[model samples]
Target: MLKRIGYTAGGFVLIGVLAVAILWGLSVGTVQFSLSQIFNIVMDQFSSPLAIDDPLNGPEQTIIWLLRMPRLLMAAIIGAGLAVSGVIMQAIVKNPLADPYILGISSGASLGATVAILFGIGVMFGENFVGIMAFIGAMAISFGVLFISNLGGRPNSVKLILGGLALSAVCSSFSSFVVYLADDKEGIQTITYWLMGSFAGAKWDMLPFIAVVVLVSIIFFWSQSRILNMMLLGDEVAITLGRDLHTYRQVYLIISSLIIGFVVYAAGMIGFVGLLIPHLVRMTIGTNHWTLIPFSALGGSIFLVIADGLCRCIIPHAELPIGILISLIGAPTFVYMLVRKNYGFGGE
Candidate 1:
C-alpha cells in the first residue's frame, strides 16, 4: 500500500512539475511574464464570450500562447515519446545501450531533412517541407531496417541492430554527399542548425499530428508492458512462458517509428532523453514495466521541459538549440551514471 501510494504521489509531483515547467517556459525569452499573468492569460481562453478583448499584454499574449506554448508542449511530447521508445528498444534487444534511434530512424530523418533543406525536394509543403521529408526518411529507414534484417532468415535482435547500424551508415554517407554537393552556404548553415535540433518552428498546426502519434504510441506500448517485461527474460524464457515476441517486436518497431518520425518532424533530433530517462526510472523504481512506463514518460517530459527552459535563458540574448543543450547536460549525467556502479542496468 505504501509503495503504491508512493508511486501515485510521485506521479502527481511529476505532473505538477510539468505544469510549472510549462509556465516557466512561457515566462522565458525576451518578454517575461509572471506565473499569475500566465495563468490569467490561459484562463482567459476559457472565459465567457463577454470577456474583454485585451485582458493581457498584446505581444506577451502572442509570445506565450502562440509561440512558447506549442514549443514547450512539443518538447514534452517528444521527450515522453523518446523515453518510451528507449524503454521498448532496450527490452526488445536486451541491451542497455539501445535508444530510440538504434534502428537508424535519426539518420533517415536527418537525410530526408538534408534533402529537403539543400535540394528543395519537398518545398511544396511550404513551412513544413523539411519536417515532412524527415518523416518520410524516418519511416523508410525503419521499414528498411526490418526488411534487411529479415532477408537472411528470421529476424533476431542481433540482425536488427546490425541492420540499423548498416543503414544508418548508408544514410549518413548519402547525407554527407548531398551536403558536400550543395553550394548554398546559408542553406548548409540551416541544415547544421536543424541537425542539432530546435523547437522554434513549432506551431498549433503541427500539434494535432504530433500529439496523436506520440499519445497513441505511448498508450499502445504501455498496454504491452506485460509482454515487454517478458521480452527482458530472453526469447527462450519468453517462449517457455508461451509468449513469442518476434512478431510483436516488429509491430513495436513500426509504432516506434511513427512516434519517432513525428518527433523528428517537429523537433529535429533531440537525443539522450530516450536513452537516459528509462535507465533513470529503472534505477529508482526497479524493472516492473507498470511503474517504469508511466514514470519514465513523466520523467522524460520533465527533463526536456527543464532542458528547453535552460536553452531559452542560458544565453544573454539568444536561445540555444535544444539538442545541443541536452547533449551538454546529458553527456555529463550519462558519464556519472556509467562511473557510479550502483544502478546495475538490470545486469546486477
Candidate 2:
C-alpha cells in the first residue's frame, strides 16, 4: 500500500518535470525565448506587463502566446483525452490491445471531418461546423459497432474489433471516394492535413470547449475506477459480483466516444497517447483504473506536450506532424513493453 502511494507520488513529480520540459520546448523554437521572456509571458495577465514595457518583445510574445502556447495546451488535452479514453476502452473490452483509435473512433471522426470539408454538409454551423460533424461521425461509428456486434449476441472483444473494422473500412472507402470525385485542390489539401493530425489549427476559442469536455469526462470516469477494475475480470467474474457489465460497458463507450470526438476535432487524431500511455501506466501500476485513469491522464498530457515541442524544434523553420512523431517514439516503446513485460492486462 505504501509502495502504491510512492508510485503515485512519483508519477506526479514525473508529470511536473515533463510539463516543464514541454514548456521549454514551447520556448526554444524557430523564434526562441529566453527563460526570462518565457517567465514574463507566463506571469503577465490583463492587469499589467511583467516588466515596465520591456522592449525585448513583439514577435516573440506573439509567437509564444498566439502560436506555441495554444498548440501545446491542445496537445495536453488530446494526450490526456486519448490516454484516459484508452484506459476506459481497454477496461471495457478486457483487451490489452485496446486503444480509442483501435476501435475505429479516429477513422470515423476523420470520415466525418472529410465529408464536411469536401461537401460542406454542416457548413450551416459555420466555423464550428467541422468539429460538430466529427463528433457526429464518432458517435456514428461507435453506435454502428455496438449495433452490429449486439445483433448476433454479446459483444466479446473479437466481435467488437471486427465490427469496428468493418465500419472503419466503409468510412475510409467513402472518404476516399469523395476525395477522388472532388475537383477542388484546396479541398483535397484540407483533407490531407486533417488526416495527418495537428494542433496548428488550435485556437483559444476552441480550446475552452475541448478542455471542459475532456476534464469533465475524466472526472466522470475517475469515479468509476472500481467498476472498471471489474471489467478486466471478464464477464463471468463480473456477474459473480452482481454487476453485469453490458450496460456499463455501453455507458463507457459512449462517454469515451464523446471525449474522442472532441480530441479528434481539436487535434485531428494524434495517436500513441491512447495506445502507449495506458500500457505504460498498467506496466507500472497494474490494471487498477483508480490509479491508472488519473495517472494515465497526466502522463498522456506530458507525453503529447513534449512531442509537440519536438515537432516545433525538430525542423528549423517547419513543424512535424504530432501524430507521426508519436508513432515514431510510441510504437517502439509499445513493442518493448509487449516483448519484455508480456503483461496481459493484469488478467493473466
Candidate 3:
C-alpha cells in the first residue's frame, strides 16, 4: 500500500511538472509572455468565443493558440510515444540496449524522406508527401525485418536484431547514394534538418490524428504488461507456461512500428527519447510495466517540453533542432548510467 501510494504521488508530481513545462514552453519563444498572460490567453480562448475585433483575438492569442500550443502538444505526444516504444522494444528483445528504432524504422524513414525531399518522389501524396513516404518506408522496413528474421525458422531475438541491422544498412546506403548522386545542396540541407527533428511544423489540424494513434497504442501496451513480463523470462519459459510468445512478439513489433512511424512522420527523427527515457524510468521505479509505462510516458512528456523550450531560447533569433540537443544530453547521461555500479537492467 505504501508503494502504491508513492507511485500515485510520483505520478501527480510528474503531471505537475509536465504542466509547468508546457506553460514555460509556450512562454519562452522569440516573443516572450509572462505566465499570467499565458494563463489569461489560454483561459480566454477556451472560456469564450472570439470575435473578429475582440482584443483576445490579437497577436497574443495567435501566438498562444495558433503557434505554440500545437508544437508543445506534439512534443508531449511524441515524447510519450517514443518512451513507451522504448519500453516495449526492450521487453520484446529482452535487451537493455534495444530502442524503438531497433527494427530499422529510422533508416527506412530517412531513406524515404531523402527520396521525397531530393526528388519529389511522393508529391502525389499531398502537401505532406515527405511524411507519408516516411511512414510507408518505416512500415515496409518493419515488415521486411519480420520476413527476414522468419526466413530460416521461427524468429528469435538474435534473428530479429540481425535482420534489422542488415536492412538498416541497406536503407542507409541507398539514402547516402541518392544524396551523393542528386548533388542538390538545398535538398541536402533540407534532408539534414529533417533528420535532426523538430516540431516546428506542428499544427492543430494534425494533432487529433497523431494524438489518437499514440494514446491508443500506449493504452494497448499497458494492457499487455503481463505478456511483456513473460517475454523477459524468454520464449522457453513462456512456452513451458502454455503460452507461445511468437505471435505476441510479432504483434507488439507491429504496434511499436506504427507508433514510431507516426512519430517520424510528425516530428522527423528525434532520437534518444526512446533509448533514454525508459532507462531513466526503470531506474527510478523498477520495471513492472504497470508503473513503468505510465511513469515513462509522463517523464518523457516533461523532458521533451523542457528540451524544446531550451532549444527555442538557446540561440538568439534561432531554434535548435530537438534531436541534436537530446543526443547531446542523452549520450552523456546514458554513459553515466552505464558506468554506475548500482544501475542494472530491469532493476536486476
The all-Cα superposition gives candidate 2 an RMSD in Å to the true structure of: 3.0
The TM-score, computed over Cα atoms with residue i paired to residue i, of candidate 2 is 0.92
Query: Which order, best to worst by lDDT?
Result: 3, 1, 2
lDDT for model 3 comes to 0.92
TM-score of each: 0.95, 0.92, 0.97
Q: Per model, how many backbone clashes are there? A: 0, 0, 0
Model 2: residues with Cα > 4 Å off, grouped in runs? 49-57, 346-348
lDDT, model 1: 0.87
> Residue by residue across 1-348, what tens digits does model 2's lDDT show?
998789768887977877797678767767888888877776663346433245655776667776788788888888889999999888877787788977788778988988899889998878868877888899899988889889877777677788888898988898888888877799889877777788888877778988999999999999998889888788899899998888888888989998998887777767777878888887777777878888898889888888878888899999888778888997888787777746667524
* Model 3 regions lying over 4 Å from their true place: 49-56
What TM-score does prediction 1 earn?
A: 0.95
Residue-level lDDT of model 3, residues 102-160, one tens digit each, is 87999999999999999999999999999999999999999999999889899988888
After superposition, candidate 1 runs with Cα above 4 Å error = 48-57, 342-344
Q: Candidate 3, 21: how far from true, in Å?
A: 0.8
Q: Which candidate is the best by lDDT?
A: 3
